[model samples]
Target: MTEVKKQKPGNSVLGLFKEIFNWYPSSYPAAERKLLFKLDLSILIFACLCFFVKFLDQTNISNAYVSGLKEDFALNGNELNYFNVCYYVAYVIFQVPGMLLMSRPQLSRWLLPTLEVLWGICTFAQSRVTNVHQLYALRFLVGMLEAPVFAGTHFILGSWYSGPELFKRAGTWFICNPLGSMISGYLQSAAYTNLSGVGGMEGWRWLFIIDGIFTLPVALLGFIVFPGVPDSPKPFYFTSDDIALARARLARAKIRKPGPLNLDVFKRSLARWHIWIFVLCYICMIIGGYPTSYMNLWLKAEGFSVVQINQLPTVTYAINILASWLGTTLATIYPSWTIYTGATGGMVFSGICMIVWNIPKALKFVAWYVFGVSGCLSPILYSTVNTVVKGDSEERALIMGSMMTFGYSFNIWVPLLLFPTAGPNGAPRWRIGWPVAMTFHILLWAGFITSLLLHRRE
Candidate 1:
């Protein structure tokens, strides 16, 4: 039997620096190193860009709404929330089925990019919406088309990279979200200033139109650039030897090119404790991480102008990118359940700040800044789940889809239920929102500890 190697406790500070710069060297052969570089360039780049576009489109709606879409469409009384709900409804409905279908042999290559193009079109269509109902329908259509891509990309990442290599790649991929957030802020601000009424449209509408125009070419390139499922015929960039090395690495790790989806796959996956535990944990993640949404709305209510509203929340995205990198890097260096503890710390800080709203306005701003740091949790949590469920490709795919679906399922109602459209003194005051976020963060931390115990006991 092969012996399982244990990780060494390298100096934490030094290790963190290495992870920060991606300077730690592995002992792979020259051939494997070449293959890894090639994969990182060809696969990871496009995947990250696709993720950037995905998030840009999703969050731009909020930017557009606050900038102008709300007034133009006569939206009122939580219709903004309803627009988000519509997206989640379609997203949740299509997620698992889409992943299952995309998992079939030879389908992902064309299918995934095709869906990206379609969604890009749907996003552009949002520029044409005339009413709340029209906005809802288009967002729903975009959701359905966008559903499978994120989870599907996670599955593909697992296929190409082993556990240690995967998290950083996942971090690189997931950082696109913050990058997108930052870009959305800049884009909306620019559009509002430069593009407003340029050609007979509101600046917010131009945000959708211009962003959609940028998305089409990337989706087209994705068709040519995305590496297909691991076990498929090698791409033109990969020689036969590189293909052999790729499969051998995965095989040595016992990562299979999962066979056809079947009843047994579902049965085995769903019956596992990790699946349910991780799913519930992710649901809490979605709920606990809800405070960031109010950043812009609060600023708006506080009488920030259109540009200020779009530009200020970007501070959170900046903090988010830094926090995400630190969290994922620490996880890569240490490889422990303790990685999640960082997220819990940020949440606790945010909760305390919110709970004590009577503090000076400067402290309230600090609380909001720290609130952005919690963005790290989702990527780190995803990495942890991928590390635990590495053995089965089908199960990994299903679990990822299930986790996202379940999280989003609750998101369909949780925000409206927990967050008021308007809060006191132009602040979300969150009376209930902050406390609920705190409770979920506590629960999520406990779940991590519980999962750690269960894993160790096993």
Candidate 2:
């Protein structure tokens, strides 16, 4: 691997000021800036588009339920939770295997886009489900296919960008999570109003059809643009010199190239604290952030009109997008310690207000809105994992996949108990849910402290 000379830290007051506005230092070479631009256009933009549609397909089920699927299918029990359970189970099963496949240089380009295409077909098939069982099967397929996207994309990102650059890019990519959900809300609203009963299909069904259509073009584009990893065979868009510069940049940052994914890799990963600690952190953050998904169900219980239900919760996503941007920017300027503490702290506050459940209507609204900040934690956490495991590519991929696998494996049962739809504790004020969420948020703080100590000792 080629190694570039390390640039001096921009520690002056002026340098600090510049960082707030620019992602790269003013002292960076013009060629490096051009390289960043190319990477952003090819890798970052495509990653965002792919993730946006993945979430759009994934979240549309909730939107569809609230729109008309619940009534049309007469879903009276905890069927929504069952659907989520099905998806989570498949996702947990496939998560690690998918990441391992993506780790192969020969498979990286083909696997991601092919998975996207298959999932798109499944997403489209959901529109034709006449019964809940068919919908469950389709959801399982979609989840299995999408299992690789988030973790796999992060692995690809870690291979190309260094620590300082990864957060901004990862955070930017993560914004699409909320963005896709936000757009699904508006899309459902529009379809319900304008396309209801068109071709004798419910507006909710149309949502799936439109979302499935969005996935295909993006997946096709990925085959053309995705550059795999820096050490892998280069795409036509990048010249040899460009690939060398990318390697030099990562080398200077002390990021090692790919090591064989053998028994030794698994042994080394398990022996380290990185995998265990980071997995716990991810689980806490995910579980703590669960109640936000129920905001629409709460609105429905409050007797809001269908259109209002669809549009109102989008504000939460908007807030989430802003919070994600602010978190990334702050991490860029100050210590990332701020991101860990600040995001979990916000979720804890929101969860407290929710658990009380008797607060004013406006206060409840504020609680739901503030919960948006929790969405920022995922990118920051994943980026930290990438940095911590930088010396071993296979280990990094394994840890990331394991984090999602264990995290969602918990979700398979956790949500059924905590956020059940049939119990007295269900919906609007999920009595058990909010308190449980708050406790996990506190646990995330512990994880943060432990990670800090581990990093220092290393």
TM-score of each: 0.94, 0.95
Residue-level error in angstroms, candidate 1, position 320: 0.9
Predictions: Cα RMSD each = 2.6, 2.9
lDDT of 1 by residue, 1-458 (tens): 00122234456767556546652347677788898898998788888888899989988998998998878876667777788899999999999988776666577767778888998888888888777788889989989998998888877887878655776777778878888988998899999999999888889998888779878988888878777677655667888888888889888877777787889998999788988888888888889887675688878877889899888888888888877766666566554456677667877987988877788877777878877777667776676666667777788888888988999999999888787565352237777778888999899878767766776666
Model 2, 1-458: lDDT tens per residue?
Answer: 00112233387868655565576655779878888888998889889999999988878999999999999999999999999999999999999999988888878877888888898899889999999999999989988999999999999998888756787788889999999999999999999999999999999999999999999999899888888888667888888889889989989878887767779988988999999999998898778877786789988988999998988888889988877766765675566776768887888788888888888989988988888887677887787788778888888989999999999999899988998887798876788988988999889878866886787677
Residue 134 error, candidate 1, Å = 0.9
Q: What lDDT does model 1 reach?
A: 0.79
Worst 10 residues of 2 by lDDT: 1-10
lDDT of 2: 0.85
What is each predicted model's overall lDDT from 0 to 1?
0.79, 0.85
